[model samples]
Target: MVDFNSTSFHPATFQLTGFPGQEAAHHWISIPFCVVYITAIVGNCTVLCIIWAERRLHQPMYLFLCMLSVNDLGMSLSTLPTVLGIFCFDVTDVAFDACLAQMFFIHSFSFMESGILLAMSFDRFVAICNPLRYAAILTNPRIVRIGLAVVIKSTSMLLPFPFLIKWLPICKGNVLSHPYCLHSDMMRLACADTTVNNIYGLFATLVTYGLDSVFIILSYVKILRTVFNIASYEQRLMALNTCVSHICAVLLFYVPIIAVAVMHRFGKSAPRLVQILLSYACLFVPPVLNPIVYSVKTKEIRKGISRIFSRDFL
Candidate 1:
């Protein structure tokens, strides 16, 4: 272990924040944080295990759900360390390189989640609009390809973001917005020109989430059209119901994200605590709630869960 006092340190450590003015309550608030973190990890892991064990779910939809769970797992694990370090241990100072690594993983997984959502929407599209050809369209190899593409797209685009922010001289003092590193939060601390960073960051967001969101919306619109063309009310309800979990997942991921963005841009005069809380909520809520939504909304997943438990009990 490198002693902080013994040798001259490097990489310019940054202080992570819990709540700006409510530092005293950080530990107390950690109770809920700990609960959410454990629930997200355990819930996503359980979803993954169920999908893996049950061969009946070996379809495009279930495969995409597995990918979503894996991405959620990555997102939870990505930020867990810094959160626990700051809240539980009061270890706030993080080496700059470590911060960048953490940022890369967090943002990369975020982008991956978006990509997976888009892929999931497409899976729903094919299943609903072209049920006969769904298997032909989303073959096992094709799903693997989409998964690889999501990983590649996220990693490649976000890889430069850290290097872009890192070389900049952090003369503004390396304090971050929340208990973790965000590219937007980190860029503000740079003394050097951030025009390139901002441009590229915006570019990445547009290309990734913006484009994905558009396609997702279009896919749903088409699904609705297809569903409505059918005469039977029960059939329409069943068709639309299939999308409920994914829609909830989308909202859970995006709503607070929009709140955080709005707070940062327009709510500058807003309390630092407000912004921090929303940021944390955006990252934490989706992973924790998604597995629950899918497991509850999708009967197959719930049945698998019940069967697993019943077997273990026996």
Candidate 2:
């Protein structure tokens, strides 16, 4: 029988030669990322404050929106600090345990965000499809329940990831290619055979992200159908407009994810820099863009944000 914790197993290893001698580009990238990180924090914080203060915005839809803002804040916070640390201080050597922890949170928050998006889609579906039942279906108690479920489900699904890494005997390679430890990337460093890990990873991805995406698409499809069957052209237009921002947000988050997945699978021997850049963009861009899309498209949020700023300055 193979001992799981045996130290005799040789670790699979790789090194991230920092930016391939282009330290200048690495420094330059930090400036834009820093600006985006600050903006995302401010924007998400404003959303949260407004949602908290305003009684009118306390419904299920807005509740989900607030949760989404919180998730985005978490997603940004998980990665940006480490990224900035790498760029500013050249402190890239992360301990093995720290890397596993980072990977766990990154994956957990990512799944949480996906769950929030699914919840938002359900909110919109009810609002459009069964307007009369909307309030009853989405009461304060129910919303709270769903929120708890999101947290519980996301946390449960990703809990095994870090623990799995911790149990493995890491015999080689401490340097990660990216600023944060990505699950797949980290798995490559394990000395043990990763067939089980890969299978479980794919399962998690399919169930959480993949299933949520399918449900979101179906919700929008029904929403679009309902809108088209409406008698009023203005109503159809308004419904379509409401969905535009959501569609854009989904695309922004998922397109880069798909791109990175494809690159990882098919772009074997692709330059290390390309892989790192793709991963970095996937992590940072969606959080930066989510608040912008919502604020620009949702008048209530925009006005609420404006009021928040005005009151703060005055």
Question: What total of clashing residue pairs does each candidate reach?
Answer: 0, 0
lDDT of 2 by residue, 1-314 (tens): 22123453423332333465766677786788789889989888878888898899898878988888888898888886577877776666665556667788888888888888888889888988888999999999989899899999998999888766666555545556677778777677677778878888999999998999999999999998999899999988987786676788788778888988899789968988788778877777778888888899988888988887798899
In candidate 1, what are the lDDT values of residues 39-142, reduced to their tens digit?
A: 99989999988889889888889999999999998999989899988888888888888889999999999999999999999999999999999889999999
Relative to the true structure, candidate 1 reaches a TM of 0.95
Tell me the alpha-carbon RMSD of every candidate.
Answer: 2.9, 3.7
lDDT of each: 0.88, 0.79
Q: Model 1 lDDT vs. the true structure?
A: 0.88
lDDT of 2 at 234: 93
- Candidate 1, residue 215: how far the Cα is off, in Å: 0.4
Residue runs of model 2 more than 4 Å from their true location after superposition: 1-18, 269-271, 309-314
Q: Give TM-scores for every candidate, taking all chains together and pairing residue i with residue i.
A: 0.95, 0.90
Model 2, C-alpha of 35: deviation from truth (Å): 0.8
Candidate 1 Cα deviation (angstroms), residue 135: 1.0
* Superposition error at 196 for model 1 (Å): 0.5
